[model samples]
Target: MFTLSEPLASVIARLKAPAQQGQIGRLRRGIEKEGLRVDPAGRIAQTPHPHALGSKLTHPHVTTDYSEALLEYITPVYCKPHDALAFLGDLHRFSYHYLGEELIWPASMPARLNGNASVPIADYGSSNIGTMKHVYRKGLDVRYGRIMQAIAGVHYNVSLPDDLWPLLREIDPQASDTAASSDADYRSSRYFGLIRHFRRNSWLLMYLFGASPAIDRSFLDGKPAPDWLEAHGSDTLLSPYATTLRMSGLGYQNKVQEQLKICFNSLSNYVGTLRHAISTPWPPYQALGVNQGDTWQQLNANILQIENEYYSDIRPKRVTRHNETPSQALEARGVEYIEVRCLDLNPLLPLGVDAAQMYFLDTFLMWCLLSDSPWIPDDECDHLDDNRRLVVERGRDPAMRLNIGGELRSVPERGHEIFTELEAVAELLDILEEGSPHSDAVRGLAPLLDDPSLTPSGRVMARLKETQQSFAEVMLALAREQAEQFRREPMDAAHRALLDELIETSHRQQGEIEAGDEERFGAFLEGYFTRAREPRAARAV
Candidate 1:
């Protein structure tokens, strides 16, 4: 049996006590789900972003990710997970209303792509910032190609309350500090610790929730299918034991990134490493150049066009101010929350995700923070990568083994060990919520562990087998069904009104930005890169 450390056990005990029942209130959470807009025939939409949805640049809630067809919906942070999910549902309802004949593809892997030309990079009006955003996507097209960029997923942003950290510090005397100035740094450091632990165990998430075991053949372009993948139909390729091909090399995998050894040991190391990548030039990107005859191809010929390009399963995030880079925000304000980037869009759900999943994530993340996370050595980090690949590619294999701290253990055995700890955390959360929702969610995952066939990936494969449908056909059918369901449901009046107001305001804001640009585009780009390279404290000085 796995044992919780003394400090974590005591924290769990105190939180579960009756006296502390209502003290925690609720942890703050936010959701960002991305889906590709497809026509009734299920092909990627070639149409521009619908004007009714507001400017993809200025809109706070709605935006385009990499391709214009990829719609990203973001919810404001909420104390209650239900409220956060409700907001996401509302966004979907509003989006469906303006989609006309199009449907939001329910899965993370994209719909059929004719080729690179068929995938349109998102265009964000004429402002410098807008152009910067567009040009960055162009750079991605140049580096990674559009098909890989079109794969979409959900990002779950979560943070515990400020008070909870003080309580945590009290429990750990070594982490305790008397100065207010140091509080933010302490919180940031602790979040990094949480990140370290999350990377080590995130394979469990891929196994349980991963839903993309197969993909449309068009997603592979003209490349030959790997030997392990079998043709599901004339137009689709399926992986027998694979969980999330979206998390696999088929999606967001870059060879250049493999060399980046970004350290999560501390905030400084993490920032320094990413900053170095942004400034460092690479031969492949350099050959592409920043522009091809007057057309901007990318922002720079560096290893990274920006920090957002460095794809990872999780990220230490801080909400950025207008015109600020992500690294700048982290350096100035510290890490406010962490974003879980590995979750596949469960095509089975109308909202792409649900309250039960959110509850499980909350419990799981808290468990990660409470657990003892040792510093991951460079070699162990490589092993961590191996573990993720194994899970995503062959997780359902009963005999699959993973290296945990230099020891080999079966996937089921390791998963059970983690679940045992998660259950205890869930009970503590249930105590905090004055209900059993958290515990219920944890118990819900038990059947999946016992019977691998019950997992989302298993269900996806089973649906394909039973129906004899291609990946696109199955996902498109679900997409059309979900669209109809959303269309039939009336939007809440308050949410409808709020969305309408945001649409009008964002359009006006984008116009103002276009009108107010005084600096030349070239100068603006140069200045932005220069400022991004400077240390935050030095820039302030």
Candidate 2:
């Protein structure tokens, strides 16, 4: 079984393992003195808030994004260059789960805007939560006001190759001198990181849809809107920045297409997806020598000034620039790696995932790649979008239809086809990892596909409605289980500390950003998008 440990010891140990002995000693002693609880509820609950923030009862707008985002990004399973996903192994047998943090914003505020201050959040908020911060279930659109720290999901990732680093900047770097001395900002660096991930790892998904209101409701005991409903559950409350599209009104073909056009307006898209057949970059552009020197820095500064001037959030503000960049990992060839985005925070399993779940995910991904989906046709491009909604709202409904081969077919039947294709994938992984999670994870998908109740999102909605508890309550129960898991399983030093630090910093950042101030809001949108463009330390360094 995979090892799990308390954040205090586990996380630090992992990050510091390669550090000097003195640093390691300092880290260990700090842990001993601080005494990692991993018991957030015990600690967090005790730290009472007069405001009583966070809720399982997500806001209408929040639910709206949840519903729509899922439709755009989720897929049944991603595989190829990402076959490692299938190698997952046995989940902790349904036991006392050690749920991680529940990233949330203050309950009183509208979920639309994030506050500058870190409030007491649960999971991964850009607040502390048990999950990954980058995996926010919500959209990180710059137009959405300031950047809110939350769990990132399928929407905020990319996968590509190492060689794609030099071509990340929207404009050339030869004009800027500081570009040499100062580190490449995260936006440029990580953009390349994303490219490498997509190029090298390849991804697959179970559903194309992301978090949806209807899907969230489906999981509840209460009846929700049927799966057939096609609409953005979010209200028409547009961000002030929505005007960037010059939308006279939200036109279907025009606006959607417009958004798509702008979103893909980057160098990489034309180079990669458009040129999948080529071995090297297309019609190769000359590389800006890394040592272009001081001239490049001056040019970059001028570019930064221009970006700051025109780029504002939904709310306008005086120019306040962010010092955005990635944490360095170049020493080890950068931290560009796969981000597992589709998995929901399983209420049934603690640690937000299981052996079977992980295994299934891995195998499913293998099948996803091996199934050999063609370069998606323009017409079929929306299939991934369709799957997101299906999985979120109607994931468990037997009648749910998913788009496959350009057709909307019921979840079960289509799932059977998908799983059938996956059998080979599972076998491959079984061979590679030798009885790893991939086999079990792939094998388990059919049951989830066939039995709606078995799905994580479905179970959450069910528990909330039938038990008549708030989403908060549902999460609390899960958290309790997860906490127990944390206690029982004993996390490694790195993982545990990562979790704890994420929680603490999440909270701290929540305090800073949740105020939803103009500067904070701008930061959220700009920072997220900016980071999206940059390179990870490995390639650039």
Candidate 3:
């Protein structure tokens, strides 16, 4: 019953050609997953990063995030989603061999925290680059507190095949009219369009995949719980109908960032806004000071320490070269891919996500790209944020309604309309496959729109109710269970050997980097900011 936009319908018709199938099958994706390391009692581990796991500063695959206890695993890009997941699974298995009794916390929320001080900031080493990383984290410690930095989630990185660009450009109305539509310009514009559409509709992802509905009382430190939250047990706080508290105000929200209206209509606009934020000083951060005596406090007194500090649900990305900032990379080579940063860890799965979910994500992302997306103005941006907040806090409410185009509509009704379009995209993708896996993934998850209990967050809440266990207790049990299963499964001998070699090489690389540094830290810091402050011209397509 859903009506496809004229642009979308035209693209689908063209994509059905025999010559386009190969390009469609060439999509690539990668995953970056973060998990907190905790002891058997579910307390955040106070130990330094395990030595056998390799140097966090130089390791390509294994590293630390905001805290030493927060382990981040990265996988290289793969054509098939399952292959990427297999690599992720191997990382977990290899780490378990050296983790001893420690377990990786399974949920998006942090494990039982002692306080802000208990969350140790990550230490990278003595190199200038290492020092910069550590100092940047300290800035986050002062800006948002270490407790919020301890929250973990999954980041999915994906890129359409290069060969598909010419096909899209041929179909683009604007490109057809323009005389100078370079490959770089067209790709970036299409990515921004995809991002705009994603910003407007990513709430659907939270409703389906969000898993952090409850948290341990200790997560708030000594602060009182908000009225919206109800006590689930002596030590657990929850919102009965919430989907992802990890994405709500209770989690990573910052008042200062809320004021930053970062534009996504064009690549230059995005770069310019980010540069202004990093270069402009804020009063509160200025009070903290960049240096105290000989000890470094932060990178600067700006609104953001770096581009990475500016958080968004989705981001246009380009892999940066050595010493080049992210914006510089985009200005030089345009967007290479996009990263989806709003997904919560599904504690029900050992890897937090599965093949079926990845298939659905691929379908949904394609639908966003194919849909007709207009540039979003500031007022409309605010409305999108409001919609996301509503779904995050009260998504499972039976009578919840969303303000779609100023008209109020029930969640199920809107969800079904979107899914109908998704089903069409799925069929297009499944053209060359033996089974309709992509279409099957879309159809299988469609029922969750009407049945809230079938959602991950709902399943977690049901577990808490049936077991009468606190949030920490339930998560710890899952962690232990998953850890045992990982240990029992045999890792590929070749993969294990590769990991072993990487551990030694990572340590050596860090040592060489520290020894090779001759530039003063202050000079390097100044040069870094100078490069970031360079003016960017509007690169609109």
The model with the greatest TM-score is 3
Show model 1 residue runs off by greater than 4 Å: 1-7, 14-21, 176-181, 292-294, 538-541
Number of the top-ranking candidate, with lDDT as the measure: 3
lDDT by residue (113-217, candidate 1, tens digit) is 898889999999889999999999899998988889999999999988777776677666566353444667878878988999999999999998999999999
Counting clashing residue pairs in each candidate, in order, gives 0, 166, 0
Instruction: Pull out the clashing pairs in model 3.
Output: none
The sequence of per-residue lDDT tens digits that candidate 2 reaches over residues 1-541 is 2221232123223333222222211100000000011123322121221112121122110111221211011211222322211111111211112223422211111122113222123232332221112223211122221122222222212232232223222223331643653233333334333332222212123331111122212121233433343322232111110111110111101221222321222233422221222112212111211114221111121112112212110110111124332221222133333334333233343323334644554444333322222244445445554454344434544565666656667766655655665564465444434344555666655676555555444444455457765443444455456545444654345433433344345345555653444443334444555553444333433
For model 3, how does the per-residue alpha-carbon lDDT over 1-541 read when each residue is reduced to its tens digit? 6787677878888987843446655579999999999999999999999999999999999999999999999998998888899999999999999999999999999999999999999999999999999999999998999999999999999998787788888777778665476788888889999999999899999999999999999989999999999998789999999999999998888889878887589988888888888989999999988896558988999989999999899999989877788898898789999999999999999999999999999889889888888999888888889889999999999877888888888779999999988988888888766688889999999999999999999999999999999999999999999999999998888778889999999999999999999998998899988877875442443
CA displacement after TM-score superposition, residue 504 of candidate 3 (Å): 0.7
Model 1: lowest-lDDT 10 consecutive positions: 172-181
- Count of clashes in candidate 1: 0
The window of 10 residues in a row where model 2 has the poorest summed lDDT is 26-35
Q: Sort the candidates on lDDT, descending order.
A: 3, 1, 2
